[model samples]
Target chain A: MIKENIAFKNLFVTVGTTKFSKLIDTITKKEVLDILQSLGITFVQLQTGKDFPGPKLDPNVEQLCSIRSESGSYTVELEKKITLKYNEYFEDFNNEIEKSDLVISHAGAGTCLEVLHKKKPLLVVINEDLMDNHQMELAEELENQGYLYHCTCNTLVQALKQDFSALKHYSKPEKFVFSRFLDKCIGLSDGK
Target chain B: MLRLLQGLNFKNYTPRYYFIASSDTTSLSKIKELEQSVEKHKQGEYHICKIPRSRVVNQSYITSIFTTLYAILYSIPLVFKIVPDLILCNGPGTCIPVCGLGFLLKTLFIKDVKIVFVESFCRTRTLSLSGKILLYLADVFVVQWMCLKDRIQRADYIGQLM
Candidate 1:
């Protein structure tokens, strides 16, 4: 089992920059819903980028917050059981990463790195539809490192049933490698 | 690109920003976000160049070469105007023209601009097309995963900077 809170729990699912319609479609399935509930995932937030495919809202959807800018746009919603909150593009998504007990995201590099750095239990649902498919390699590599778990959209329901406690704690290297390298490259001119 | 810029800033190196973006809605929007971030978070000089995409998803290799040359032609004046000391690029079609032009400047001894290429974190086992080209061209080549560094001898594994 992932955890035994016997109380409140939060789940955050993000599809990264692009809209993975299939991801949102698969997660809302009845079977997945049952599995999530059993795992004590009470507060589930789905960040459907740009196109928020309106799922069958049998549970009355409540509007939470909405924001729009020239660069991007996002919306938030609250449901009764799954509490589906949406924020398409956050200025700083670290806040969401910090809050969530579990994060189910597409195997996008940026999202995966951030989630791993935060040391959260992440289940990456790979989008097989992508042209590049490097995401598959990334997700698998992360799994090998014991930093996160990976599965296709179809296998997400099964993947969630596995014990997450056995997963190793991720401590991403915090060394100033880039800066030190840059400093070594160029020395200041006027010596300010 | 934003992460690397922020990292450099945190290291106390005050540097200006010049972005050469591919002419795609998504790419343009991302560039705008970077511009806004520079303005909001730090008082820094920044410029954006909306250059045509050198290559798209399914362009023929012959056409790709032509488009890249075209992109270089469009970007020449801007590259000269900026004449950045260090050119940082990740995985993007825009990088080809930007880095290619920068390399030309270096070749002719017009400027000793150093190029740093970062392979996207997603790429572990192999290099992307951009990564492959930049691998030979970029003065400093960095990879996020150790497996990749092992595959390519030149790539420096810097852990995850994203």
Candidate 2:
């Protein structure tokens, strides 16, 4: 087994700008962390949306990192090999995404597009609680294309166990195909 | 829409680029980044025009009319300033007034501008609010999803732009 490299985190979980308490509650459990540890994930960065009130962790789980608190937000590391850096939100997650090995995100179209644009390994967790959620279609299409994997809150464990090393990279529609079409529409064609 | 501008081959002609930004607090910082991006990728004159939101959320019909009219008043000068050959917009409230002005310009035999409306990639099954409205106004309407072509008339089933 490879020793944990302390530079970049292995896992990044984000709930976007909305509350996803179930996702937060699910990952914070000891059993899940143990599984992640066995899989050689030494670090976790969780972006719980501002409304989760924070996870009520087990009393026996102790924090393992020294944090410099800014904006009164707590960044804690759990015991065992996995260290967790928790925050309400970053100004942007694009930089964080670049550093992460795997990303678990709520099924927001913005987040899905960003993750896919960066060519990162993505696992989307649909927020069943949202009303008239049209965002699910994007996630479904992405999964169907073999660009990403997906699961609901209940099936996160199974999703985590799935091998993603053989994923078919998402090939974006050629930049100039749409441009050439636009040129025809706008009458900028060479023949015209 | 900025991506479209970036993709254009500028060897022939360098058309003036007008990036319409929503007149909100966040737009100030975004304009800087947008300016830098446009400068890096494309060469030619570029301007960022701020258009106010057409309607405040939860606003009553009476107040909304006034706000929309106010947005139109602000948009008139920007439209004339641009005098664009083509205006490609996604589904945003700000796009409506700009496209309307472009359409008006065509009808009046003023500047000829093609108003192209590209539906947002997120809308697979149905058209967005702007798409619903622009189906009548725009000269060319494009949808990224193929399913949308069957339900909506005059919507070209183009591949995803974003």
Candidate 3:
């Protein structure tokens, strides 16, 4: 049973660059939109332009006064400013990440790590043109860790509309092992 | 010595770029075709030597020797003469050799020469086995997008190669 007071059922996602990465489906924006719609979520989008900050913010939070001006293409600045703005728009954004049942983020492993740290149930989309499919590799690792759901935009929406707990259960052990592996690989064992 | 290497198709030509590579003499023979095809075309100066077949061990795995040998044999002497500040490496296969030579010349002779790796792959992240080695050797690792910069620890994320 889904709840009613939801302020952000659909997420308008953003990315940092407009380059040739296949991770974000440089060719598949409409596919992403269709999936989001199928998930019973509204499609709020923020494709990056060459502006300093990158794209537009979530429409609801625009009322806040503490919002600072971001730099780089409009879309870039929006992504950079999101965390801080979320802090200011706490209730609205919190409900958004929590009640919406899913948050789809286009950030790479670093940003995905942050989303995982927040314990949000997320769908991570990886672009293809990355070095060794590092983003997908990381997504595989994170999916193993049980941190979030990882897929191309199309797969993600399909997975989200169904029972996510099944996917979540399978991803847990992998995420755990991956976290340990990362700790060892990065030599952060002492948590330093 | 601003030499370019390729089949020299009129489609790939830009103003004043040199043609240095071709798959075979059929392509080599077509250099004249390229010359006459474009309105702004200039005559071919010299033909690039074909890289003989050989085995190469890429960073991730073993590859044909031709990839490493040809790039090195053909590009090194050019680097010594032209001393390009930047080598827009289309991939590890081609750019690695130019960069290796660039590093050697800069360390042993000329100083402050820069090599920029032009990332052309459309999907996947993390440096290719050759790219992994080239990253340490290159002066600037330019990615097509900043998103790539996240996965790559040290690249400059210059937002596109072309």
The top-ranked prediction according to TM-score is 2
Better structure of 1 and 3 per TM-score: 1
RMSD of each: 5.9, 4.5, 18.5
**Candidate 1: stretches off by over 4 Å:** A1-8, A56-95, A172-175, A187-192, B9-15, B22-46, B57-62
lDDT of 2 by residue, A1-192 (tens): 323332224889999987897887777676667667766778888888885565556444545434445564666665446777678888978998988888899988778878888888888999888766777877777777698898888888778777776566666667786778877776678523
**TM-score (all chains, Cα) for each model:** 0.79, 0.80, 0.35
| DockQ of every candidate structure | 0.47, 0.44, 0.02
Residue-level lDDT of model 2, residues B1-162, one tens digit each, is: 555555666543355555454655454565455556654545555566777877653456688778778888999987887777778788767788888888989888898778888887878888877788899888888987777778887889867676
Which 10-residue window in model 2 chain B sums to the lowest lDDT?
Answer: B10-19
What digit string (tens of lDDT, one per residue) describes model 3 on residues B1-162?
A: 111222223232233222234444544555556555545534333334444322232243345554567667876666677665444454525446667788887888675666655454332345555567777887666554455578888776532221
lDDT of each: 0.74, 0.74, 0.46
Docking class of 1: acceptable
How well does chain A score by TM in each candidate? 0.77, 0.83, 0.46
Q: Runs in model 3 with CA error above 4 Å?
A: A1-192, B1-74, B160-162
Candidate 2 Cα outliers beyond 4 Å, as residue runs: A1-9, A17-22, A49-55, A58-73, A190-192, B10-42, B55-66
Top of the candidates by DockQ: 1
- Models sorted by TM-score, best on top: 2, 1, 3
